[model samples]
Target: MTTREEVARKAGVSVAAVSYVLNNKPGVSDATRQKVLEAIRELDYKPSHAARTLKTKKTNQLTVFVNYLGDAFEAGILNHLEMESRMFGYFVNFQTYHPEREEELRHFMAGRIDGVFLLGQSLRPETLETLHKAGIPVISVMKPVEPGPVTAFVDIDWTASLQKTIRHLKSEGHLRIGLMANLSETHAHRTRTLAFRQAMKAEGLPFGETDILSGGGRLEAAKAAMLDYIRIGRLGEHTAFVAASDLMAIGMLTACRESGIAVPDRLAIAGCENVLMTLQTTPTITVLDYPRPEASVAAVRLMVEAIRGEPVASRLFDSRLLVRQSTHMGG
Candidate 1:
């Protein structure tokens, strides 16, 4: 099928300009419109009926771009985003994001979705520019970095949350503390790592590269790393571990279980994101209760406001700790 994207590429014009010309909208200059029409004729472009209708009016469709749909926390946020977006006459769809999939994402922008909710992927500069020219609002959820043409974002105060967790661990008499986190070079991962350093410094504790372990942000990876740490004799005496995610903590628990180390008694552990799997672990993982629903609602609200050309500001939410058997002092 010859899409408007092909016509836009052939005519050397923006996709929005092609859309304007095809729908008889008054946005593109006459010269550009003529060029687009010529390109359309040359390419024999034929849009689908739904695409034809979208060129003329709003489609009321929103996209939720995720790094991975299997993530428990992201799945919870998707569920809430879909449910809340319905009140504004918007429906949500999922899209997997990877740096190499820029062309696929651009092809998806043939006047289909009204806005996008980015969960964890960073859009390329050209993709952001194209979306901007198309007048599409892009709101990121739990993205701490500043937007580069993105409309708005929602995130949590990672420094404060991590500090609180660290203080609690210290108060529980855990003097030798270490951190386990995903090795991905994302804003959230950096924020968590920095916050861990700041919190340890505040508590007058030692923070070094040797104490911070990277597990590539997967369950098996974390488990393997922990087992290696055990074999390397790095699971020091009376140590407390903090993971950047609940899945990592669960993997750490598994390592401890197989090594015959008692949780909380010998090795206290805490994790971020209080997902369902936290409770399902052998020793329920202590985790941070991230405001998933609130963040989802905020993202939807920002998108709706931005789509209407209304001013919107980025938002930040707070996190609370959920103490469980994984780190309970009494246990």
Candidate 2:
């Protein structure tokens, strides 16, 4: 815990001289530099990384901001981002982005990270503007619901994916379908919800407000929501469900177990953003492979390009259905 002032006092030189020596900047004599180096060694002083970053104009560090780190889909994306970014000599940092934690995110990201990766977290226009004005490059892992001059973004076509999922369920003779979407309003959720409505209309199926339930992006919350639907007899009509996320699908599966409902027999379920845990469920849940690994690679590549003053472009990956034990056989 040695300060430049202490080093200066010990070396019998001004603080500015110690700074110049530590940062390898000009305007310090060799004798003064040697004295400062000796004082630093004697005191076992380590230069501040924050101060050093300011002097060098780079931290070799990037940040990945997520709404929740515990989410399996997000975790998978983060894993790939870290691995790919490291190959380029960049270290990754993580921060949680919540509505209540906006101020904390702003303060933490200011001039600290060389770049940022936003994973499905919505930001205010002002916040985005501030980051743009600061000359910090930011890449979004999901398309923002609101349009802005964001540096870059990567996403998949949720509407087309959901339409395919619904068509599969319909072809399997599922008359009534329900949607499990997160409570929070995000571009992914909104797109999926709208897709569900459009698909239901195309198939001539009835869609009701109650048919779209909030999955809440948590195991416990989704289970509780499904349990509530069951208690009210609302769950009896829907033959199949399309969940916005795998965690919510797993939660609904748990609810079906507690209610003596047999999956793919009395009810079928499918999830978006397939995670590894989906294979571990009692009856493996069907899901849409989100191609997040590829998105991760693309995000990092675009971010590094933007960091290097190269032109950047947004990217979109593909999503495909993966049938499993949770859903009935279909054409």
lDDT (CA) for every model shown?
A: 0.82, 0.83
Give a tens-digit lDDT track for model 1, residues 1-331: 8877899999999999988776655668999989998998899888675856554656778998876666787789899999999988787888877768777878777488889888755687788888888888889887734366777888787778887888888778888888887756653566677777887888888888888888766677888888899998877743899998777888889989999989988899898889999998878888889999899899899998998899999998999988888888675
Which lDDT value does model 1 have at 22? 68
Candidate 1 structure, TM-score to reference: 0.81
Among residues 3 or more apart in sequence or in different chains, the pairs in candidate 2 whose N, CA or C atoms overlap within 3 Å are none
Error of 1 at 119 (Å): 1.2
lDDT of 2 at 165: 82
Question: Which candidate's lDDT is highest?
Answer: 2
Give the C-alpha miss distance for residue 208 in model 1, angstroms.
Answer: 2.1
Once superposed on the true structure, which residue ranges of model 2 sit more than 4 Å away at CA? 1-48, 186-188, 199-204, 329-331
Q: What is every candidate's alpha-carbon RMSD to the true fold?
A: 9.0, 6.0
Give per-residue lDDT, candidate 2, residue 257.
95
